[model samples]
Target: MEWWGVLEGLLLVLVLAALPLVLFALRRRWLARSGSLVECSLRISTRSSRSGTPGAGWALGVARYSGDELQWFRVFSLAFRPRLRVTRRGTTVLQTRPPEAAEVPMLYRDQRIVVLADSEGRQIDLAMETSSITGLLSWLEAAPPETRYPV
Candidate 1:
């Protein structure tokens, strides 16, 4: 009888330890099913005024288009809100290039990276698959005609 109690206690501890991971998986699934999600690697540009070097490193996240804005949420996070949001009207693709060999291990295989500048002049790097690049370009170009003016 005492052994049974010990077994129950051990099981409870295991469940408690695994609860966060289970919740995170559920959140990720819900996000994916709720909208268009693109798997991407993101890094804040190193050219910011605060620092000459990049901050920390890349983060793996899912980018979802919510109306006219793109929301980025980290994959491993438990938070329900996006960490970054970029409006379509203010986003510009500054450049696109294949990942370097060192970066290849950090990103999805065969995915290309794009450098984008927002209206605030902040640079953001996004790495995604080739097909996703096409989708992203189409989304960026699909801004309402009234929102676009001659550069």
Candidate 2:
């Protein structure tokens, strides 16, 4: 084969590999422009699932408040629907702590971990910027007057 043919083949492979990444970035940007998107990390309790291990671990995602539910979507996924949704009613902020020494590499400097418990006694963890905690708390607090959820 000629040198030009080899070069052309290599170029085609590189462009094909990069096409998905470019589309992923474009999709993320579109999500940001469509709503009040936030950079968040989510961890649910130990449960068997297809996406990851049976044990719970932090997965990077974006969250947006919609009515009474906080919709979370995986950053790496191209899915149109949320991966998880937690309602404001009975959503309690159990505790919040700074990221651990081991977690520092995975999280932003201003981010902290917030633990929440739903009314059904299931636990959900969220990591978000320090500035966004108050906003999240307020969203939980601003539920319908009859709900009366506390942070």
lDDT of 1 by residue, 8-42 (tens): 99999999999999999899988888797899889
For candidate 2, lDDT tens digit of each residue in 1-151? 5999999999999999999899889888877777889888988873233234323377889998888899999998987789999998888888998877766666655788998988766688799997688889888888888886653
Per-model clash counts, in order, read 0, 0
Number of clashing residue pairs, candidate 1: 0
The lDDT, on a scale of 0 to 1, for candidate 2 is 0.82
What is the model-wide C-alpha lDDT for candidate 1?
0.83
Give the CA lDDT, 0 to 100, for residue 89 in model 1: 86
Off by over 4 Å in 1: 49-56, 149-151
